[model samples]
Every structure is written in C-alpha cells, then in structure tokens.
Target: MAMVCEGLVVDLRKLEELSCLEGRGMASHYYPPCPEADRTFGLIDHTDPGILTVLVQDNIGGLQVKSLRDECWVDVKPIPGALVVNVGDLL
Candidate 1:
C-alpha cells in the first residue's frame, strides 16, 4: 500500500515529502443483506481526512462516488483481489 501511495503521489507531481509519511490506519465495513437497499445507503458519501485511502471491497457492490463536475453518483464496481486508492482531502 505504501508503494501504491508513493506511486500516486509521484504521478500527481505533488510534493515528494509524502514518501516520509509513516502513520498507518485501517478500517473494515460490513453491510448486511437488505431487501430495501435502495431506500438506505450502506455508507454515506464522504472524503477521507488523511492523505490517501486504500479500499478493499467485497463482491457486493454499493460504493459510489460523487462527481465533482456534475454532482452525479458514480457506481464503483468491485474487482476481485483489487484495491481502490483514493486521494483524501488532506492531500
């Protein structure tokens, strides 16, 4: 994950000081089967407060991202054994 973050920072042409970042944290989410899935959200839309977020999603698809340009909800399809990297607000 550290390598991924470093690569992203480099690709963005951002400051290279992020390579020295040492803080680490993790979280796991579980959503039960809901018959009325449309009426409720598994997770609310929000941005990570840290510099980056690496997500590992299950086969169940519910993740969405709000488009900054159009304010539309975009579905994030899950890929097996893949990680989704997101740039957080702090970056």
Candidate 2:
C-alpha cells in the first residue's frame, strides 16, 4: 500500500522506519433515528481529499455517491461481507 501510494519501489522496512504512516487510523460512526431526518443531514455532501476510504456496511444504509454522468446522488446498497472502497481525489 505504501509503495503504491508513494510511487516508490522501496523496502517495507525502510518505509516503516521513515514513519510515513504515523497518523493512519480508522473511525466508526453511529447515527440514531431522527424524527426530523428530512430536515437535516448527518454529513453534508462533500468530496474526500485523502487517498482512500473503506466503509463497512450495516443493514441500515445511508451512503450515497454522486454520478458525474447523470449528475445525481445514487444510493449504495449493502451486500453482506462485501467492502466498499472509495477512491478519493488524492488517489
């Protein structure tokens, strides 16, 4: 992952020694049912500036991706045990 991200064919040990991946992390979010859900958004529509985003889907789905060709937001349905990878602008 580091090699591909950095565009370098270097040793893994050297990459780790450089501490290039120090702040990497994962996060989990929970949004309880809102009575006025239509009046607000948990997260505003925006673009991710990082390299990648991996999402683990729950039965209650709210993810959406905008289609450039159609110019609309499309719902992302979850498939059991399947991972959704979003390639960001940095990639």
Candidate 3:
C-alpha cells in the first residue's frame, strides 16, 4: 500500500515539493441498513480537501459519484478486493 501511494504521488510530478507531502489522516465508515434509505445519506456529497482519497467499499453498495459531464449521480458498484482512488480538490 505504501508503494502504491508513493507511486501515485510520484505520478503527480507537476506538483512542486513532493517530498514535503505527508498523509493527513485515515478514516473508515460503516453504513448500516436503514429503513428510510432513500431519504437519508450515509455520507453527504462533497469534495475531499486533501490530495487523495482511497475508498474501500464492502459488498453493500450505496456509493455514488457525480458525473461532471452529465451532472448525474452514478452508482459505484462494489467489486471484491478493489480500491477506489479519487483525486481530491487539493490536487
């Protein structure tokens, strides 16, 4: 995982002073089954403030990514043993 993260940082070569970069924090979320699923959100839509966001999702699918081209919320189907890497606003 460290190697993967390092490679990602290196790939952003345009960013100046890469050596000064560090991991800000780590987080994990658990969304339990809700009766009013349609009326509630486990996490509200927002842009990540950091450089990158690594999301590990379980089999319960609810993740959505807003499309820049269509302006629609698209479901992100969960795949076993897959990691979702998102480029944050800071990038």
Candidate 4:
C-alpha cells in the first residue's frame, strides 16, 4: 500500500496523467491517488480517505504518511505483527 502511494508520486514525476497508471503494477487498485479529481499530487501530505488500506511489503516496508497541517511524516516504529490501520472515513 505504501509502495502504491510512492508509485503514484513517482508516476506523477514520469507522466502527469493519473489514468495512465496501470493497476497491474499494484496489488491494491483501491489506493489510487486523487481518484475523483483529475490531478496529480493533490493528496500531498494528508491522511488516506479509505477506511482501511492493506499494505504489502517485500521484507522492508515502503510507506510514508505525513501530517498535512504540520507538514511532517508520522514515523512508524518497528513492532512485530503490527497492522496499523489509519482510520479516516466511517467503517
């Protein structure tokens, strides 16, 4: 899930089109950046809108979420079997 967010940002760097992003390269198609708005990086430094985002990592993790107002990343500490679910919208 983290990589998906990072990939979107990276894709924005390569091509400005969000629609061009292929879900085949992603495990979760539900984590598209700016799903509604036709914009790139519009979701910068903000919390996720999804109720629960399931992330997949290859040994090392690759997700980075930040505070929108304060402008800082919320560092995730190492914890065994930790499934951090950032709640935003209603479940």
User: What TM-score would every model get versus the actual structure?
Assistant: 0.64, 0.63, 0.67, 0.32
Identify the runs in model 3 with alpha carbons over 4 angstroms from their true place: 1-23
Which scores greater on lDDT, model 2 or model 3? 3
> Per-residue lDDT of 1-91 in model 2, one digit per residue for the tens?
5655355556645545666456686777767667777897657888876556787777667789889999999988867567788776754
Q: TM-score winner among the candidates? A: 3
lDDT of 3 by residue, 1-91 (tens): 3444567676443454554255567787766777887898456778888777888777777779999999999999999568889877776
RMSD of candidates 1 onward, in order:
4.0, 4.1, 3.9, 16.5
Task: Specify the poorest-scoring 10-residue window by lDDT in model 3.
Answer: 11-20
lDDT of each: 0.71, 0.70, 0.73, 0.46
lDDT of 2: 0.70
Please give the distance, in angstroms, between residue 24's alpha carbon in candidate 4 and its true position after superposition: 20
Query: Which candidate ranks first by lDDT, i.e. highest?
Result: 3
How much lDDT does candidate 4 score? Answer: 0.46
Candidate rank order under lDDT: 3, 1, 2, 4
Looking at model 3, the pairs that clash are none
